[model samples]
Every structure is written in C-alpha cells, then in structure tokens.
Target: MFIRKLWAYLLGYLILVIKGEHPERLINLAYTRGVHLWDLCWIDAGTLTAKVYASSFRTLRHIAKKAGCRLRIRRKRGLPFLLFRLRRRRMLLVGAVVFCLILYCLSSFIWTVEVSGTRRISQQKVKELAAEAGLRPGSIRFQVQRDEVVDHLLRELPEIAYAEVNVGPRSRIRISEKQLPEPGVGYCHIVAEKEGVIESVLTLAGQPLVREGDVVRKGQVLISGEISPAPPGQDEQQGEQLPPRQEPRFVQARGIVHARVWYRFYGEAALEEIQERLTGRKTLIFRIKVPGKEVIVYGPREVPYQFCRLRTHRYKLQRWRNISLPVEFVTIEAEEVRHQHVRRSYEEAVEMAAERARERADRGLPREAVTVRRRYKVLGGDEDPVRVVLTVETRESIGVIRKFRPENQTDKTGGKEGV
Candidate 1:
C-alpha cells in the first residue's frame, strides 16, 4: 500500500468528484478501459468521489463523460504539484535552503558544558579549567582536544586524581579528587574525648593513665606518651652503686579506652498543626523556548488556582551525535493544593514527640557505640505542647590523640612533669 502511494505521489494524483445519474457506470467504464481508480466512495445519490493517477485522469474523464457523469477536480497532491507551487514562490525555496545551511553550521559548535563526579572542588572551577583548555561552549565539538582538557584539569588542580572529558552535544567533564591523609603529630597522648566513666582500657603503645571504673573528664589524659625508665633494682641498691637517672622517652600514644557516655536529646510536637494537601485538580501549559526568549504555545498563561504546586519538564528539540538544536519544549503542570488544620490526641502527640526525640538522639550516637540504656521523660505544663526528653547511655571508645612535648631538662628531685 505504501509503495503504491509513493508511486502515485511521484507521478502526481488528483481527487475528482463525479456528479450525474449514472456515476456507478463511470467506475465500470474506467475499469474496463484499463484506467486505475482508488478510494472510490459515494458522496450522495448523484455524487461520487475517487482518486486517480494524474497520467490516467484524462482517460477517466473521457470515461465519465461517456457514462453521463460530469467530473470535477477537487484537490491535487504529490511532489510534482509541490515543486510547481515552490516555483511560483522562489523566496520561500531560498529561505528553506538557507535554514538548512544555518542548522548545519550551528550543529558544529558546543552549546552546553557539564561537570560531574566532583566533591570539594566546585563544578564551576572545573568548567573554567576546561574552558582554558579550549573545550568550552561555542568551541567546535570535533576540534576540541579531550586529552588537553584532561591534562589541564589534572595539572591545574592537584586535588584531582583522575579526570575524563567527553565532547558531544554537551561537553561533560568527570573528575575524581585525591583523598589526602590527615597530618600526624610525633609525640602524642590519648585523651578522653568526652566526660564518661571508664569501662576498660587497652594500650597499644602508651602508658596507662586511667583505670577501670574511674571517672574521666574531657581533655583528661587516658594514656601517657612520655615513658620514664624504672629505678635501679634492689640488688643494685645493695651494691652501693646506683645507675644514673634515665631520661623520659617521647612516643606516639595509641590506645582504645572504652567508656560509658550519655547523650540528652529533646523534641516537641503540637497537638494541632496545619498541612498542605493536593486537591486533585491540575492545569498543563506548553511552551517553546529559544536562545533568548520563551513563548507559550498552548494553555492559559496564568494559573487558575491561587495555592498550587508546579512541576516543569524540559526537552531539547532534536539531537544527533554531537549536534543538538537550541530550541526546547517545556511543559509545566500546576496542581491545586489546600492547607487544613489537623488535630491529634494528647497520647498521639506524645508518641510523635517521643519518636522525634529518639531519632535526634540516635543521630548523635556513634556507629561503633554500643547502647547501654535509654530513658524518656515528659516535661512542661499542660499549656505547653507535648515535650519529650530522651537520655541515652552508650559504651564507646573515648580515647583521642592529644599532641604534647616533654620538657628537655629532667628534675633531679624526681618531680612529676606537667602534660
């Protein structure tokens, strides 16, 4: 069917209306005379419609006349007729050709630049670096060197460990930042990070300063990094000769001090609250956006509802390989909404407040901490909203490295050194 239509279009075709007493006879006569006719239908008792190839229309007209029917051409279609029409409007033909050339020229240049996989390093910074390497917007997509852009990023930004550049309709620059280790201190002590009751201590390379069941405050040393040698033994003392005083050695402290820590979290919820909900009514607006301006193509310009939510979707006109048109189709959907006051019972409000408090407390808890106990309490008077205070106790390692330097001179009087 498509091939037959293409053949008809290449040779041109005409739609004719036949009006007479014996229009049916015309169809028979045309078929008997070897003239092709298609889409035959009766418009009325005296009128009929049919499509015939332009080359065979003259023969069909003769057949119609002999069958006592008058033929009238209704419409003309096909490429031949289109070319004839364009021949009369030469400027339209020229404009079409110019549009094609402009489209082809615009497709060669880049329109958008995108950066992904960046953290700590700003996307704008990466884009600027890429622009310096000649891979920015308006640059030729095929001519921009991806390797140069990658190299420029890696060199200009020391934090970037890896970079990849892809040039197409939109230029994309992907980068991975180098993970740097934290600076270290040579001589350090393990100190309590928070006030807690010590449960146990495990020393890896430090002097124990706190014992089990002892209460330690924040910043208090849990382990000492300075080590002083033991005094001479009883046998050496009896020999009447004592070894010289030994100097304290400074070392990096490493230990784990598990302690019980407490966290207090508070939350409240009102028995009455206002919430917004959708009303199920929506309006859709379609628009076309060009480089400099946007035009509404369909739907109303102003939203009908005063309180509403808006969602927008945008689509580019056309894209092929590294080429994309500047035109975009935008659809905006506005949904009507209404706010209503909702009332909850006292028990429900208390539960809600308690859940919020629990969540807040859990967020503050460390991943390695083991939960020991939890307690919840209600606070405030009846006039106040339901309030909840949550107290959580957990056992966790409280030791943290604290750097310090020991005094160069040791006191002969055997006085303890200050940390």
Candidate 2:
C-alpha cells in the first residue's frame, strides 16, 4: 500500500472516469502499451474509473480516442499539481521567504540581560560597563566576545575581583561579579581597644610601646608611630660626650593587637505566636500573552480559592540562541492560606530564645578570632517573654587605625622639632 501511494505522489497522478462505447477496449490498449493503472472499476455499462500516473494519463489519450471512449479527470493530486498551483501566486511565495529572513535577522541580536551576584554594584552600572565592551542587549550575539567583556569589567572597576559574562539563549546575557574587599584606613596608629594583658605582639610596621606580658588599658597605644633609631654599630660611652642629638621620626603605626574581648547578646520570644501561611488549596490557570493582551486558553477563568496568594510565572517563546519571541506562556497559581496560632512549651521557647541569642553574639565575632569561652543564661519563665542572654569571651585583634598628627607629638629633648 505504501509503495503504491509513493509511486502516485512521486510523478503526480489523476483519478479518472472513462465513458464511451467499448471502454474495455481502452483498458486493453493501456495494458499493451505498458501504461500503469490501478483500482480499475466499472460503475455502470457506460462508465469506469481508474488511477494512473500523470505521465501515463497522456499515454491513454490516443488509446481512448481510438477505442471510441472519452476520459475525464475526477481529481488531481501530488507534488507537481501543488507546485503548479503555487506558481500562480508569486507574491505569497516571496512574502514567506521575506518573513523567514526577518526572523533570522531579529534572532541574531541580543535583547535582554540578567545580572547576578552583585551587592554594591547596581544593575544599570553593570549593563553600562558591559555595553562599552560590546556585550550589551541589542548587540549581535555572534559579534559580542565574552572574554573581552570580562576583561573590560575588571579593568574599569578596581573593586571587582572576579567577573563573568555568559551569553545564553533567547538573546540574553548573564553577568556575574565578585567585588574585592576595601583596604583598611590609611596612615593611622594601632591602639588598644580594651583593657587586657598582651599575650603576644606582631608588629608589621610601627614602634612597640607595650611589651609581652604587659597589661594595657583601653585607648592605650599598643604600637606607637614615633621612633628614635640607635646609632648603627656605635659604642656608647656614658662618660664621653654624645656625637650629636637624634630626633624621633613620626610614622603611621600598623599591627595586630590580640586582646581578650567580651561579646553579649539578649533575645526574647513569646510562647504564643501567630503566623500566616498557605493552606495547600490552590488553583492553576494557563494562558498565552502577546504584547499587552493575555488570553486564557485553558484552566479556570477566575481564581477558585478565597484568602489565597497568587503567583504567576511567565515564559516567553524563544528560538535559537537567545532569540525571544513576542508571545509568552503564563501559569498562574492561587494558593489558599490563613493565619495560624502556635503555642510553644517553656522548654521549647527557652531553646529557641537561646539559639537566637547565641546567633546574635556570634554575629559580632571577628575573623580569625578564637572563642576562648561561651556562656548562656535564661532570665524569664515560659509564661513571660522567654529571655535568653549569651556572652562570649574571644581573643582577637582589637587594634584599629587611629590617625594622628605628627605635630601633636611632644618634644622629648625640649627641641623645637616635634617627635
């Protein structure tokens, strides 16, 4: 059956009815001439129908006329006939080719950008920088280079430690940026932030004021910027006069001052609490959106649930490599929800409050600091607001840059120059 149909379509064929005297004679002539025919049937004494290739149809003409029979085409089919019809509408064919060309052209250009992993940097700023590097929306996808764009971002923004520009489908570009940490305060002295004994000292730059095992108080200068260098390899004769008087040089102090610090946090929570949440009842509506118009072809016309939260997700139709289409498919879901009351036992509330307090205390911890000790205390009963207090003892750098003027240093030798 497949072979017969294929043969008919390949050369184009016609279904014909023959009428005249001795139509049987025409059939015999077709067989003798090797004209392919199938499904030959005699409907009445004067009429008969059969299938023949379009090329064989003309071959039967002379045979039918000689046999005193007339052949009439009941239906025409196949590629040849279709092409013949299409040839008449020249403009339609041209329009179809033009439409395809336009689609391809539009798809080659970028349309939108998605930025991720940015905190201080704004979306517009990122886009502007990307635009300068030829990665902006509306730029040609094939023309825009991702590596070059990344290089441009790193060069333009000193804060950016890492950057990535990824081109994806639907004419969209995704940007990822990691910012470098800002430098510490410049030109300042490191001072003691709390009263504690100096366990050990590591001076990167500056003069050491307090030595190891020395007890220092709050606001005390742990590392001083003023220094008087001893004469190189020179023997000091106390009985002899000094060669000359040396002046102390003032500079910015820098170093880590490890001191014992205390962190305290307080937290309270009520035994009874109310929260609004979804009730698991929801309705989903599917739709198609084009420009400013939306048409729902499936699902409910209106939301089926009351006191519900509605979430709509829309996906625009797109083609090869980020070529977005104007049409979009949207799924809207309505979830029913209500206010819920939660009652916690005294033990439960205390644990919750304690965790919150602990988190708060830990929040203020400095990087690389060792937690030497930790303690927790509960102050209120479950009937009252459960209050939990957390305290932590840490050993970390309490030193921060405190800038000072060189002129403020007192003259140790009563000289006019300040140390």
Candidate 3:
C-alpha cells in the first residue's frame, strides 16, 4: 500500500471532479482500463471527486467523453507538480535551502546551560569553573570533556562531595553537585526525648546531670553543656599558700543519653461495613484543553455512567526552553460502581481489629528497639463494632540533642524548653 502511494506521489496525482449523468460508469471503465484512482467519494447528486495519477487523468478525460461525464482537475498534488511550481520561484527555493543550512549550523553549537544540586555554590561561580574545563555555552559538544569537567568542579570546590556533568540534546549542559555535611553546632547538650527511666549515661564532653535508674521527664537535660573544673587538690593549694582563681567553664558538650519509652494505641472495626465496588462498566474520554477552556474530542459528550467513579489524568506537550504550546491533553475514565454491605464473623472482625491496633502500637518505634513486652485486650463484646486496645513496651535509646544557650543569648527562663 505504501509503495502504491509513493508511486502515485512521485508521478504526481490530481483530484478530478467527474460531473455527468453516469459518473459511476466512468469509475468502472477507468478501473477495467487499468487506470488507478483513489479517495473516491460522491461530491453531490451529480458530482464525484477522486484522486488519479496525472498521466491516467489525461486518459480519464477520454473515458469521461465516452462515458458521458465531464472531467476537470480540482486540485494537483505530489512531487512532480510541486517541483513544477517551484521552478517559477527559483529565489524562494534558494532562500529555503539557505534557511535550512543556517538552522543546521546553529543547532550544532551549545545554546543553553543549566546547573543544579548546588546549595552553597552559586550557579555563576560553578559556570565559571565549568568554562575553564570547556563546558560553557557556545562550546562544541564533541570538544567538551565531560569527565574532566566533573573532575575540575570537584577539584575547585572542596566541599563538593559528588559532581557530575551531563550533556543533553540541543546543546544543553547540566551540572549536578552535592555538598559535604554541615558543620556541628557551636554549643549543644543532651536531653531526654521522652519521660522514661534512665538506663545508662555515657558523658563524652559534658557534665553528667542524670544517672542510671534515675527517673527523668520529657525535655529534661541529661547532660549539661556547662562544665566546672574540680577544685584544685588540697595538697597543691597548701604548697602554694594561694591558689589560682577558678571559674566555671562553659563548653559545647556532647554525650549519649538512653531512656525507656512507651506508646499505646487503640483501634475498632465493625462486624458489618458498607463498601463501594466497581460494576465492571467503564467509559474513557479524551479532551483538548486550552488556557481557559476545554473541548471534548472523543467519547460520549455527556457522562455515560450515572453511578460511577472518575479518574482524570493530564499530559502536557513536550516543550523546549520556555517555549510551549498552550494546549494539553486530558483523559478521564469513569467506572460504574455500586455500594454493598459486607458482613464479617467474630473471628474475622477480631483479626482485622488486631492488625489495625498493631500498626498504631508499632508507630514511632525505632528499629533498634527491643520488644520487651506486648499486650492486647478486647474492650467490647461481639457487637457490630468491636473496640480493641493494644499496649507495647520497648527498650531503645531516647537521647536527643538539645542545644544550650550561649552565655550572651541565655533565655530568661533558664533554658526552660530543654529543662
């Protein structure tokens, strides 16, 4: 079929209007005579239009005469006629070729640069570094050293832990950078995250404020950032007769404070519940959307399903830079549905309720937590809705870093937020 179309296009074709009393006879005669014609359709009561090869169209004129039909060319198409028309506009042809050449040349050069993933480094600074490695806009794509550019960026920015340069189509350069971890706080302390008994305390650079077996409340400071030097030994003081004055020293203390924490959860499920179910009937609709309006291009104009659930998805056309058509395609699917009530037995309801309760009880439990104990209980009898309560106990580190106030910016409440 494609070969036939190509043959017609190369030899040229014509849309001829056959107007006469017996146009149908003209079509049959042409077919029997081995004259190719396509896209045949009735134009009106006495007129018919169809495509015929240019050479065969000439013979069609002869057939039209014998068949009592008058034939006239309505439109001319295909490469032969196109070239004939262009012959009269030589300058236009030259200009089109020149425009195409210019486009091809311009597309070969890089036009845009995009930098991403740099938090501390500015885009302009990064671009400058990239330019030194031959990655700036207007540079030849084949000439740019992608790996060298990445290595250069990493070399110039010590904080950058990961660097990559990706060259995209249309001469676009993208730089991805990942910076190092942020520096530690100048001053901070360890505080209890929840109300629990202190399991143990290990002070690395802070004053121990809580000890093992000591009960502590949420937000209580387990290790103080401030440290006071122990009083000089008595023997040293006696030998000197006078000891140097010692003042309490403040430090950015750090330590680990672990405490036991507990959580509780409750859940309820009915023995019978109503649920929406699909009826297996569905309709898919397509639409074209402009900036402010939309028109349905396919499917039923009016919604087909009365009791149905709808899901809509939209897709925007592929774009280049900031240039894009203000048009979008949307597809909507409506599935017919109905509501049904499902009844469950006591065992089924209990199992469902327990699962829900377990999810809640496990909420916020750390991976390192060791489950010391768990308890479950039904709060109500075999009612439609049965209530269940779940309690869990786990042993895990609860130490949370709580920053200490600077000496000059001390809060009036004496660090009340962290106790």
Candidate 4:
C-alpha cells in the first residue's frame, strides 16, 4: 500500500470532487476503462470525492461527461507541485541545502573532549596532553590518530599505566594509573577485635591459640605470632641425654576467625503521629538572573500553598573554555503539601517499632556480617508508645592484626623494642 501511494506521489495526483445526477456512474465507468481511482468517498446522493493520478485524470473527465457528472479539483499534491513552489522561492531551497551542508560539516569535527579514570593526574593535564597529540576539540575526527594519542599520554605521564582514545563528536580519553604495593608489617599477632564466641578458625601462617566454639573477649589473642618447637625425645636404648630446647620463633600471624556476635537495639513508634506528604499539586516559576538583579519571567509573586517544598534549578548558556556568562535561567518548582494527624492501631505501632529497631541494627551491622537469628521484645504498657527491643545475632570475622616486637629485642637507639 505504501509503495502504491509513493508511486502516486512521485507521478503527482489530484483530489477531485464530483457532483451531478449520478457520481457512482463515473466511478464504475472509470473502473471498467482501467482508470484506477482510490480513496473514493460519497459526500451525498449526488456528490462524491476521490483521488486519481494526473496521467489518468483526462480519462476520468471523459468518463464524468458520459456519466453526466461535473468534476471539480479539490487539491493538488505531490513532488511536482512541491518543485513548482520551490522554483518561485529559490532562496528557501538554497537555505535548506546550506543547513544540511552545515550539519554535515559540523559532524566531521570534534566538539567536546572528556577525560575519565584519572585520579592522581588532573583531567586538565590529560586534556592538554591529548591536545598536543592532535586529538583536541575542533580537530577533524578522521585525522586524530588514536595510537599516537595513547602513546603520548603514556609517555607524558609516568603514573599512567594504560591509555585509550575514542574519537568522535564528543571524544573521550580514558587512562589507568600505576599503583604501588603497600609495605608489609612484619611480626604481628591476630587478636579478637570484638567479644564473641568463636564459630570457626582458619590459620594460614600462625600458631592457633583458640579452637572453634571457644568464647573469646575483645583484644584477646586468637592466633599467636610466637611459635614453640617440640622438645627432643630421650634415647632410652643407649641411655643418651636429651638435646636442649629450641627457642620460640616469632613471625607474622595471618588467619580468618569467624565468630557469632550479638547486637541489641531499641526503638519506639507513637500511636498518634503527624505525617506530611506532597499532594502532587505543583506551581512553576521561571526567572532570569543577571549579575546583581533577578527578573521573574513567569509565575506568581508568592507561593500559593502555605506549606510547600521548593526545588530550584539554574541553567546557563554553554561556556567556551574558561569564559562563563553571569546570566542564568532559573526554574523554581513549588510543590504543595499538607500535614495531617494520623492515628495508628496498637498492633500497627508495635510492628512499626519493630521494623525501626531492625533497620537500626542493620545499619550498625558490618557489610560482611551474615545474619543468623533475630528476637523481638515489647516493653511498657499497652497504652504507652510501642517500644521494642530487637536482638540480632550475626556471624562475622573477628580477627585483626596487632603488631608486636620480638621478645628481648633492642632498637638502634639502644632502647627496648615495644609494640
């Protein structure tokens, strides 16, 4: 159907309104004569409307005369008519072509340059370096060599480990910086950071001081850095004496100690409370700010609602490099709100209080902690505000490194070594 309509448009067509004794006779005669007519609509008992191709309209005129119907052209359409109109307004055609050319020319040049993944190195520095490599704004997109830009960035910045350049209308340059490894702390003991019952222990390079299911206190050593070697056995057959005991060795302790920890939180919710919310009715105020004065473009002088929320956003014209305009387009959105007193049931208040206690506990809990169980308790009389005590049990790693000097050690200053 679209192809047929496009064909009619390319060849030009006319909308004709036929009126007289019998307009249907004209349509039947045109159909029998193999002259196609589409979009036929009966206006009344003696009038009809239809569209016919410009080339076939002559044949329709003859058909109309034989059917005793007079035909009047309603509208002329298609590319031929458009060309004729443009032929008179030559400047409009020229302007349209020039606009298209401008868009095409602008698309070939880079307009904005952005730099990402930069931490130690400043974004401005990276952009300047990229500009030196011929990847700056206003440069031709096809002429900017990505490989050269990447090489330039890596060579100019010693901290940059990797670099990538994407060339387009808004060119983006991404870089990865080199990271130095942290120095290691030698000879340390792993101690319990919190008081809990040990659920499990994984000793990687340490002497185990406590086993699973053992109750430990805060600052207690869960894994010791001092390791003692086993004593030599006696030779009973030859009656030989036992060897001397070896001294204990102190090394860094490394391990994971998971323990079960408990937390208690208290919360309360009033049975009667006031709640304020937006009524979804809003008023907008637009203004222009220039230097020291502001002028309102539209909207009321004062807010309509007594109690409302105001959200203001300011926009300015696009700046070039370091130059910025003082004028700003400010839009203020005032949303009307109403406050009402709400009375919740005793059971509802209790549930709300419990949820609040649970949320508080969750916020205080560590991200790596896994919840194991929860218990809730209600306090106060039924008439009082719903007060709840929430007890949460969780399992988490409780081991932390505690540095200590070796026994009987001395520093360069002739002072005894300390933790």
Best-fitting candidate, scored by TM-score: 4
TM per candidate comes to 0.45, 0.40, 0.46, 0.49
Error of 3 at 179 (Å): 19
| TM-score (C-alpha) between model 4 and the true structure | 0.49
TM accuracy, model 3: 0.46
Residues 1-419 of candidate 2: C-alpha lDDT, one tens digit per residue? 99889878978999999999798888898999999789889999989999899988878999898999999999999989988887998788889899999998988888887777677778778888888988777778889888888888867764444576776434333444332112333345678877777876667677888877787888888887666665645446655544544766756665656667777889887789876798877788999989889899888888876677888898876576877678989999888888789888988888889888877776867654678998888884445789988888877666666666555545442222324
Better structure of 2 and 4 per lDDT? 4
Query: Which regions of candidate 4 fall more than 4 Å away from where they truly are?
Result: 1-183, 228-246, 312-331, 407-419
Q: Which candidate comes out best when scored by lDDT?
A: 4
Query: What are the C-alpha RMSDs, in order, of all predicted structures?
Result: 20.0, 20.0, 16.3, 16.2
Off by over 4 Å in 3: 1-184, 229-245, 278-282, 290-294, 302-307, 316-326, 361-368, 380-384, 406-419
Per-residue lDDT of 2 in model 4: 98
Which whole-number lDDT from 0 to 100 does residue 244 have in model 4? 54
Cα lDDT for residue 47, candidate 1: 96
Angstrom error at residue 256, model 2: 2.0
Candidate 2 vs candidate 3, lDDT winner: 3
Clashing pairs in 2: 169-322, 170-322, 170-323, 171-322, 171-323
Q: Rank the candidates by TM-score, best first.
A: 4, 3, 1, 2
Residue-level lDDT of model 3, residues 1-419, one tens digit each, is: 89998988899999888899878898899999999888989979789889998988778888889999998888998999999999999999999999999987776667677777667679888888888998777877778878898888867864444566776434333444332113355456677778888876667676989998899988888887776656655566556544534755555566655566676778888888988899898899999999899899999876777678999999998898999998999999999988899998888888888889988766756665667887788886877698888777776666676666655556553332222
